[model samples]
Target: MAIPTTNRAVVATASGPVDVLTDTELDVPTPGPLDLLVEVRAVSVNPVDVKLRGGALPGGDGPQVLGYDAAGVVLAVGDQVSAYAVGDEVYYAGSISRPGSNQQFQLVDEKVAGRKPASLDFAEAAALPLTTITAWETLFERWRLGADSTGTLLVMGAAGGVGSIMVQLARQLTGLTVIAAVGRPESREWVRELGAHHVVDRTDLLAEVTAIVPRGVDFVLSPFSAGMVETYTQVMALGGSVVAIDEPEGVDTLPLKWKSQGWHWEFMFSRVIHDPESTAHRELLDEVSRLVDAGTLRSTLGTRLSPIDAATLQEAHRLLESSATIGKVVLAAG
Candidate 1:
């Protein structure tokens, strides 16, 4: 089938709250030779979108589309698109430099897109892409944890979107013990149910974590940084590493110097932006899809907003801004 030439989208006219978002028509983006045209069914919001929409970006402006994660059906393949065909259900967290998934039709590099899990709906599938990519890449690629390696992994902010999937992926895919750090009582149980071996409250983070891992954890991952590099440094075993998705809380690297500690930053959109070693992300998504299909990975959709409209998406953004959302928030098109 021929690809459409225009699309409906929610666009940000200027950086601010969700009120900046408006429904608009845009020229349908054409796929590059290596890209594919996706008929978007659902999209998930992340803090990164908030950052860009709020003018945190260096020089970003104009009517920016803010969604990163998406689940959709492939409508048309670019000339070089060899991995997928039209009508294939797919999911992806697109590049930060390009237009994102907040549109009815979007262009994405085929190399970074994965087949959606057959068992999940578009909303559930959308919830997995960005967080799953961040968690999976951070654990396996950055921290070097393997399926056969046995060690305890401390997950900070463990009830959030990425952490929810991180808990399940750690429990199901790796031999490592999963230590989930959550603040509230309900969040603790939530992580525990998702397969965390131990759940600690962030109110007294180091003490609670040490109580669970007397010898310290082998690795620590923070979904939202709150001086975690320094605070969690002591909770990691000697030679252990810390990885963060968000900016750290002004930590001094000196504390980690003696331990030869490694710090990593996971940005899932890097592949899509720079196109550096792009196929690696596609492979990662493939692996995540397999894990999901095998029931080893779970989507982290905590809230669902309908019809992918401006007002509903605004509410989703508001909920995320509250900083208490437990899991991924999704906007699904009817």
Candidate 2:
């Protein structure tokens, strides 16, 4: 198949409402020295996509393509690319700095792309990469959980996409006890099925977690870091740390001082956009592919949409914004 001169894409300009999201055609981008021109087959909506669409997370003053998680086929590779070929299947959470995977064709660095899991199709594969990379980086890189790492890990947002995969990763890769924080009755059994050693209501995180651990949790992945800092300080063990995925601006470190505790942040795109030389993203994705193929990990896709257009994308943005979505919502790309 010959590559088209113009690429079909969904683009946003200022980002006020879902109506701002529109379908259009743009030039097919040329790959850089280490980039891959991927024909995106499927994409999943993320919280960041919603944020970016609402102008909460601002992008360049150009046509912003709001997507990150992608499962696609490689149509071409840059001169320096070695790990993948033209016809290979791949998946990745593309960099925040470039045009995103919502387009028909997008340029992603080879170091940020990995082979799609053999066990899953495009929509399922799309559901994993962003959340998988986020969970992997948070567990292994930030908190340094390993075979020798024996302690309690309390995941505050445990039923969501990242939390779902994080539970499985911690259970399979380390010796730590995973405490999944879920308020709804619907999610309790689900988290347990995903390998959570303990389940607690998020309404009273401190009381429920204390009853389970009794000695305080070693690490936590709390979403709203600023408001929960004081409560987290009380529930955390001495020298323990909290890894947050949201805004850290109002999070005062004063509470962590008494116990010698720490508060860290994990944004999966930090390395890809800022430190382009790191192969950690690709390596982690490949490792997770092995896990998925081996039946140790699973896709967290909750809903599926089709044909990747403006109205469908608007619906995706609305669903994610509601904050009640159990898992990831994916779309079949053109």
Q: Which has the greatest lDDT?
A: 2
Per-candidate TM-scores read: 0.94, 0.95
Tell me the lDDT of model 2 at 53: 80
Tens-digit lDDT string for candidate 1 (152-253) = 898888999889998998898789999888888879778988999988877787898788778788888877666556776688888888887887557566
Candidate 2 Cα deviation (angstroms), residue 259: 2.0
lDDT scores in order: 0.84, 0.88
Tens digit per residue, CA lDDT, model 2, 1-334: 4677989899887667888898999899998889899999999998888878887545655468889999999998889999998989999998877888889999999998889998899999999998888888899889877877899999987988889888999998899999999879888977999999999998988899999888799999877566788998989999989989877576677888999999888988888778889998899899889989999898988889998888899999899887777778999864
In angstroms, the error of model 1 at 273 is: 4.3
lDDT of 2 at 104: 93
